[model samples]
Target: MTDNEALASASNSAIAAAVARLAEASASGVPRPPVRDLIGRDDLAAAYAVQAALTERRLAAGARTTGRKIGLTSEAVQRQLGVDQPDFGVLFDDMAHTDGATVPAGSVLQPRVEAEVAFVLRAGLADGPLDTEQVRDAVGYGVAALEICGSRIADWDISLADTVADNASAGAYVLGTDRRTLAETEPADVVMSMSVNGTEVSTGTGAACLGDPLAAVAWLARTARAFGEPLRAGDVVLSGALGPMHPVSPGDTVTATLSGFGSVTVRFGTGEAA
Candidate 1:
């Protein structure tokens, strides 16, 4: 066997092992140790391979791919995670929720919430220049969004690869109803404020998301295409957090207001929020 091909086979084996470890954690509701020991701590390719394997398994089991989510767009978050570049993860249909929906507890392990702008695409990103302009043109509208992130790695002790393998640490998402076209709402200029039970906890502007939310989407489009799976029409892309993500407890109400895009709120099911 060729040297490169043989090494790839070994890598694939390692990725599969990592995927199984994470899946067990998710199924058992017990976070496991970092999978980085299997897939090198910085081996993003192998980590993504684990992600793909898990995604395929889910798809085979009838779980539908709804969209994609970008992570680490905030410079502060990037610094906190010690990564300069961002990562992407696939979103499943089951992870989506509407405004005012109550997310029950125990569904997400180690839940943390962050506010973002979500774009619903009007065109496919398969054959485009994958630039900011093309990304903006492809968007049907933007809405306020809240991403409830979770980790399968114990205590969230994860490297970049570990989180990537855990589907960018995605948990659930909530979208607002007041949507507006790109011309109607300038995402980069919008301000964000997130409160829990009427107390403000996080605040930021759309520009905090990789300078502009559109730029983040453009990056995701290019990255996904390079990975040989470009985004499709009608996909909902969750732009990375505009600020820091805050953890929640049972019965906490999370309400995020995106100035131009309106607000999105999610209630923890009586005692369910992390």
Candidate 2:
């Protein structure tokens, strides 16, 4: 290999080690510095790969791989982050909360909420130039989703590299009960509403997700495939959120309702709001 390739490999391995340490610290409730503090370079893909490796390690250690989440899908968010598209992260079984479920705050750090659409994958999607229709066909069903994100890095001041190494800030998620089959609905045009403590917070459409949630998924699939890690069947895909993310605290009740997908509620207890 060339010198640059060797250096890149070393850098990727180092970043992956750091991420693994961070994940262990988070899971064990140990003290640590912000992720940004440790990110010494601007290689976004390597950093993201490290984050994915951390999640993969967790999965190997018995954390069930339940789903995947898309982040930075909105134009505004992308502009703010200086990214042209969205990022993806893994979701664990322990992080999946049912509708109306109450969770302790200690499980997550600086939890934030975003309303989104969830797709249950029916088959595997390999690396390629995937069209929107192919993404829709790969999707088995759609449901309302709430992505509960948390940052391991202090102050939540992170660049794309730092965020990538932090697993795209995916912490927890809640899913709506209503599941619509792909053939029965239009995933792109659905409307959604999010509220906190019974107060309406935001309104948006699925189109906000790179024109449609499936499109976002397709983008993620392509990206992952490029990295030699294609998505497979039974993986739940969380399309990017529709509106601004809402920070949450203990005692907060968040409800994200979709026009045809119904609603999902998450109640944060003092322990679950970490």
- Identify the leading candidate in terms of lDDT: 1
Q: Which TM-score value belongs to model 1?
A: 0.94
lDDT of 2: 0.78
Q: Candidate 1 at residue 194, lDDT? A: 96
**Candidate 2 residue lDDT tens string, 51-156:** 7667667878888887678899977556645666577788888998889888776688877788999999898888446767778778888899898988776666
RMSD of each: 2.8, 3.4
- TM-score of every model? 0.94, 0.88
Go through the candidates in order and give each one's C-alpha lDDT. Answer: 0.90, 0.78
lDDT of 1 at 258: 94
Scanning candidate 2 in windows of ten residues, the lowest lDDT window is: 1-10
* Cα RMSD, model 2: 3.4
| Regions of model 2 farther than 4 Å from truth | 1-17, 28-33, 79-84, 272-274
Q: Give the distance in Å from residue 237's predicted Cα in candidate 2 to where it truly belongs.
A: 0.3
lDDT of 1 at 222: 95
Clashing residue pairs for model 2: 104-271, 104-272, 105-271, 105-272, 105-273, 105-274, 106-271, 106-272, 108-274, 109-274
Model 1 steric clash total: 1
